[model samples]
Structures are given as C-alpha cells and as structure tokens.
Target: MRLSNRNKTPFYSFIYSLAGIILVLWLIAFILEINKFDVLGDKSWVLLFIPTVMLLFLYLSGRPIFEYDSDGEALNFRNCHILFLLSQNNAKDEFPKYKLIKYNVVNVLMFSTLYVYVSSKKSNVVILKYDLTFMTKKEIKDLKFSLNKVVKTNGETSKDDNTVID
Candidate 1:
C-alpha cells in the first residue's frame, strides 16, 4: 500500500489549519499596528518571528505519513524495510534526511491510532513521529509485528543507511 498522510486541502483539517491561519493573521495585524508600516522595530520584528515559527511548526508536525509497499521497486530497495522522512523545506523538491542511519529505535508509543516514534542513536534524542491512520486492524497488527521485528533484529546497528526510494 502507498499512502501519504498529508492533507493537501487543509480546509478539512479544521482546527489545525484554522489555528494556523488565525494566529498568522493576528501576528500580521499586531505587527502592522505596532510598526505602522514605517520601520519594524526590533521587538516588533521578534513578534514577526512568532507566526513564522508557528507556521513552520504546523507544516512540520501537521501531516505525518506512512507509506508501505511490499514491492520495493518504487522505494528503490527490493527486500529490506527502511524508515525515512521526506521534508518540504525546499521550494522545488522534498529534502530527505533519513540517511546515515541517524535513527535507532522505532516504538509504538500510543496504541490508539498508533503513534509510531522513531528516535535517533545519539543522546540529544531527535524523534520522528508518525501518526498513522487508514490502516485496518489486521494491517496495524502486521505493521506492529514488522516494526517490532526490525527493532528486535537491528537494535542500533545503523544498517538503515541502505534504505532508499528512487
């Protein structure tokens, strides 16, 4: 199965999108009122950063996706299962940082709707969260089984660098 958790039309996402837009608009209004369109003061400029950071947070944490393909030709690997993140930081193409086997553990932290957390090998503890939906009960069991097998088998070996998608 091929799936991406991104809701392109965020209008249906309701709370999240509404919050983002409302916050951004409020910030813009605040800046306009304070700065008077003359010159943005230092503190007012800092206020400008709030909305930008909020939007970035919304973008990054908004849509967590899970894509599974038993057939790995699309993913560029034939047999092994790999985990990677596709980022939209770039304007043209998505920048992926799943290389170098930076992550070590994959744990199903929350059972309801299945929140999968991927953490790095280092101590700073960067975690990638996947909020998965659209999966059937049996599929979730199979997914849990497969991910558990990967964790049990790998155990910080960092062989994940071999994972790829073409």
Candidate 2:
C-alpha cells in the first residue's frame, strides 16, 4: 500500500522540538552572558552550533520514509532505516528487519507504540512510533497484516495461539 499525502507529520511536532531546543540554548547563553562571557566572542557560535545542528538533524529525520517492492518470494524495502530491512535473498533471517511483533500496544495522535520484534540473533535496533508516522492508516494496517503473517509463517513466533493483532 502507498502512504497517503496526509501521512506527513503535523507542524506542531517540528515546532515543539525546535522551540524546546532553542529555548534551552537561549537559557544557557543568557547564563553565560551574566558571567561576562561573550558566547559569540571566540567563534563560540559553535556553542550555538550544537543545538542548530541538532534541529537540522531532527528536521531531516523526523519524516517517515520507505520504498518497497516484492523480491520474488520476499519484500524488498530500500532505506528501511528502522531495520535496514531488505535483501534479494529469501531466507527469513536474511531479509533484514525480522518482525513486526503483531501487537500494537499503543497508538495516539502525537505518537504510537509498536513492539517490533526483530528475529536477528545478532545486533539490535531501536525505533520509536514517530518513525512510522509517515505511513498512511491503510498502509499501516496492510503492513501489520503483511509483516505479521510473513513472520508467523516463518515459525519465528513463540506463542502457541496465533492471536494476530488487528
């Protein structure tokens, strides 16, 4: 399924993150000013650089993004940053991001909480619901069904009863 145009993040999240960062930086600069420390005196703009860089990184990364297509027997997702989850190989473990836990614990307008289970016996990946905010509602449902079915069928699931998440 394709992501809807409406899947883009609300403007407030950016405003919130930026505003919070800027406010904290301004506070720090103000404190320094009280100490007769000219924050801008020695290319200390670099001090300001820290939060500026952070905001840019957040702006660039706050958007959810993914490109997917079928790879014969498996799905190939390019730049699936959450899991780096794509490959030509059909092995259940080879396709990268292992599982979409089949259980959505929480979902809200500002955020969501999905307990994604990666089957890798190696490194771990950490992700937040914000990462999936770019996907449309239909796309999210389709993905939940697709990934849960795929992982369950692969026999990686530990539960005896299917009890798939809806």
The numbered model that scores best in lDDT is: 2
C-alpha-based local distance difference test score of model 1: 0.42
Worst 10 residues of 1 by lDDT: 75-84
In the range 64-143, model 1's lDDT, one tens digit per residue, is 33454323322111111111232432111111223212322223432233333334456544334333433345655665
Task: Give candidate 2's whole-model lDDT.
Answer: 0.48
Candidate 2 ranges beyond 4 A from true positions:
1-61, 78-106, 112-115, 123-130, 156-166
Compute the lDDT of residue 46 as modeled in candidate 2: 65
In model 1, where do residues sit more than 4 Å from their true spots?
1-16, 35-42, 69-142, 147-166
Per-candidate RMSD, Å: 11.9, 10.4
Alpha-carbon deviation at 15 in model 2, angstroms: 12
TM-score: which candidate is best? 2
* Error at 128, model 1, angstroms: 14
TM-score of each: 0.35, 0.38
